[model samples]
Target: MEPEAKWNGSSDQVEFSRMSPRSQGFTKLPGQKTCGKSVLLFTFVLLISAALWGTLLFLFITRYQEIVQDLGKLRESCVYHNDSGILTVIGQLQETQLNLKTNVPQLSKTLNKLQEDQTTLKSKASQFSQQLNRFEEDGTAFRSQVLNEKNTATQAREKLQEEIQKLWIEFQRANGSICTKCPENWQVFQKKCYFFGKEPKTWAQAKYACINLQGRLVSIKSREEQVFLNRNANKKGSWIGLRDLDIEGIFLWMDGSSLNYTNWGRGEPNNQGQGEDCVAMRGTSGLWNDANCRGQQDSWICEKLATC
Candidate 1:
């Protein structure tokens, strides 16, 4: 058996070496530095966060400044508007004051002139009223005077008419008949005076008869003659010296004088022609009318130059 082959698998001889403590630990080959990778990743994320925060802060500050500038501008505009309004009001007040100052004197002058005109008009009106009052007083007095004069004249005229009427009545009454009331020495021939014995005849015949005796029919001239003849003559209608000529209504006396006085009965002398050719007295009334020349035998009236 060869001595059991030396069985220790030893290739080299063992030697004991001594080492330092720092170098004694087994060290893994340098690990890939995974901790450094984790740190880098964290730092990158922190930097991005800081940049985003700074940008947001800057945007907030700019917006705040813009808001403050707009507020200041608005306040300034309000102040400016208030000042403009005050100035406008003050200017208007000044213009009004100036206009009043310009017009006041002119208005005062016009008012004074109006007062003067009113005074003049009042004076004229007062004068006119006084004149009118005087005229009225004068007119009233004149009317009274005229009325008094008219009354006096009317009374005088009425009295004269009454006297004339009384005279006419007295003459008529005395001439109505022949009586002892007649004149003395008068002989009654048919109630009229005659020369003792005178023949009674017609108007034409007696006219001729009287002519032969140098006398004519009685001519009545005055109121005394009428009264005397009326009292003494026969009172059937008697002839008068008055007669109408052949010309229709032309009456005249035998003396060829137109009769200015005529005493005729109402509507008498209608000239009933045929045989009525003479003018006669209608009785003692002294009224006359046309009648027949020989109407009737009443009396004869003769006229002669007065013997006594």
Candidate 2:
């Protein structure tokens, strides 16, 4: 048993209590009554608390690591989605650029076509203007030609009128009415045409000239025919269609008909020692006379049927 230490007068002396503080199976110490069983129980309780704290800390650290891994996976998913969006935008831009390249050349070609069409229109307008000028020149030339033709026709009409006036004056001085519209330089009788010669010819030549006019030499069928022919002789002896070539002193007409008419002059048909075989009419007395067939210095007269 152990005595309890008194505090007041116990500097050197200790007081003892009636109850001892020591328990069973304890190592008693100075004045404390600590038992071995109590000490061992306290130590066991401290060990269990330390073990629980360490287990709680380990569980928190494991949960934090799991959260960090989930965050990393989310970041990777967002990056992939953003990259796909950017690629889609870039592809759209490239398509737009290609469309611009294709359309721009077509627009340029259309503009060029418009310019060409404008130039062609201008060229055609110039050609049309040139053609119009040519047409005007041709019209002027045609009008000039028509005016010249009109002037020529007027001059011809005036000359024809003067000729008609001269012919009317001559007809007033004749013995009978004149025929109209005879050929130029030919005298018109009742139904015959007479051509007067300016030059002299032989009796045979005179007969041939009448033949060339579609007739024979003049033959007197009546006194009126003889008088009509003598007026045209103009004071010159003219040949008649009378000859004695077949028989001397038995005269035959040049037309081979019977000698049905005669108008012998005063010293007629003596043959004149020159073989006078052709007959002629004297213009002064208008009487028939035999002449040499080859005699020159005699005017010729041609007779033909009148065409009108």
Output the number of the lDDT-best candidate.
Answer: 2
Q: What is the C-alpha lDDT of each candidate?
A: 0.64, 0.74
Across 43-154, the per-residue lDDT of candidate 2 in tens digits comes to: 8888898889889889889988998999999999989998999999999999999998999999899989999999999999999999999998998998978886875575
Which residue pairs clash within candidate 2? none
Model 1 ranges off by over 4 Å: 1-200, 273-275
Global CA lDDT computed for model 1: 0.64
TM-score per candidate: 0.34, 0.39
What value does the lDDT take at residue 184 in candidate 1? 43
Model 1 lDDT per residue over 39-73, tens place:
99999999999999989989899988998999899
Model 1: residue 187 alpha-carbon error in angstroms? 7.4
Q: How much is the lDDT of residue 216 in candidate 2?
A: 59
Q: Which residue ranges in model 2 land beyond 4 Å of their true spot?
A: 1-182
| TM-score, candidate number 2 | 0.39
